[model samples]
Target: MGSQSSSFSLRIWRAARDMVVAWGRIGYLGAVVGVLLLSPSTYRGHALRPILRRMYRDTAPILLGFTLLAALICLVITRIVVVTALSYGLSRYALEMVIRVLVLELIPLTAALFVAMRCTIPNATELALMRQSGEWAAREQRGEALIRAEVLPRVVAGLYASVTLAALSCVVALVTAYLGVYGFTWAGLPGYTRMFGQVFNPSVTLLFVLKTWLFGLAVAIIPVSTGLYARPTHHDIRPGGELSGLARMFAVLLLIELTSLMGNYY
Candidate 1:
């Protein structure tokens, strides 16, 4: 019993240590972003263009599919909100309810998670392979151009995909909400705009912007940082390292979502 208890305590300590290391790597996003800002000069060399193009190709389909899914979800939720509000004789609040629920909260988070699943995991794997193969070391020896020509493109591409998906999904949800509430007409535009104004007051608007930006940053940042933590000489790269990074990334995402909810509702 004492040995079992000691083993359990050791496990807890290791888990805590890993969590601290993951949080420390979150600072890497700042450095990556700073490098990304200076990366445009590398565009003149044309080396980064293919990478950007490939990232776009990979991301566009995912964005389109996820946008369609978000639209379907928005339609279903809008219908339910409209029906429930009408059943309660509170039909007047249906649009506001959809805007607050779908637009402000769900869409951005959904987009972030979609992009993280689609983009971040593969990018993490690629980075891990590069690190393990000594390619990252070779690049470091070459110069900062490796970051500009290689790493920053992937980082920026992920950020772009996250932001684009969220913005598009939010627009789709708004349109679906409008059509669900009052089909095939602009007559309700005035009231809808008024409700939008009221629900998205300055504070709420700021929060939405901040939350979406954080979502994009999280999707772009976490996996790559964790993947880069791989030991260059480590051979067994299968189960433990990859899963640990993904788990930590999603945990950070959940934390961001909870923080947003608390800030807005609590």
Candidate 2:
């Protein structure tokens, strides 16, 4: 019993330690982003150019698919909100409810998770495999700029993808909300504009923009950081490679989402 207890405690300690170290690495990645952002030369040459093209090819189809999904979801939710508002005799507030719930909250979170699952996980897995194969050791020995030349583009691409998806979906949701509420007529445009202005006041608008930016950053940074920090040793490769990074990424995403929820609602 004593030995079993000791083993369990040891495992807990190691897990905690790993999480701390992973977060420390993510902080370093943040710093790298800052430095790269300030350095004009980081965007020069063919290094980042090709990456942009490649990322577009990789992410465009998935983003298009998600936009359609967002449209369908927005339509369904808008119908429900409008119907419920009418049932409660709050029909005038239907558009407000749609903008507040669907546009301000759900779309951005869904887009971030979608990009993280579709793009970041695979990127992290490839990076881990490279790490396991000793691809980075030689570069490190040569003092190559791993963060600037290689990883920076991936991070930038992921962030761009997140923003694109969120913005596109939000637009789609707004249009769907209008049509769902007012149909294919411009007769209700003035009322719709008034409700839009009401729901998206100064504070709420600021919070919405801030929340979307944070979601993009989280989706971009967490997986790459996890991949970079994963152990390259054979014994740890199979178990710890993708699973640990994914688990950590999801936790951080949830934290960002919950904090945004509290800030917007409370």
Question: Which pairs in model 2 have colliding backbones?
Answer: none
Q: Can you give the lDDT of residue 129 in candidate 1?
A: 82
Over the stretch 42-158, how does candidate 1's per-residue lDDT look in tens digits? 566576675678568657788778988999999999999999999999988788988989998899998888887788757766877877777888988977465555556667777
TM-score of every candidate relative to the true structure: 0.85, 0.91
Question: Once all C-alphas are superposed, what RMSD does model 2 give against the true structure?
Answer: 2.2
- The local lDDT score (0 to 100) that residue 102 gets in candidate 2 is 94
Model 1 poorest 10 in a row by lDDT: 232-241
Candidate 2, residues 1-266, lDDT tens digits: the string is 99999999999999999878878899999898878878887677666685687579557879779989999999999999899989999998788878988998899999998988787666766677777888888888899877776677778878888888999999999999999988999999998888888878898888888888888888888887877667767565532236767677678778877887798789
How many clashes in each candidate?
0, 0
Q: Each model's RMSD to truth, in Å? A: 3.0, 2.2
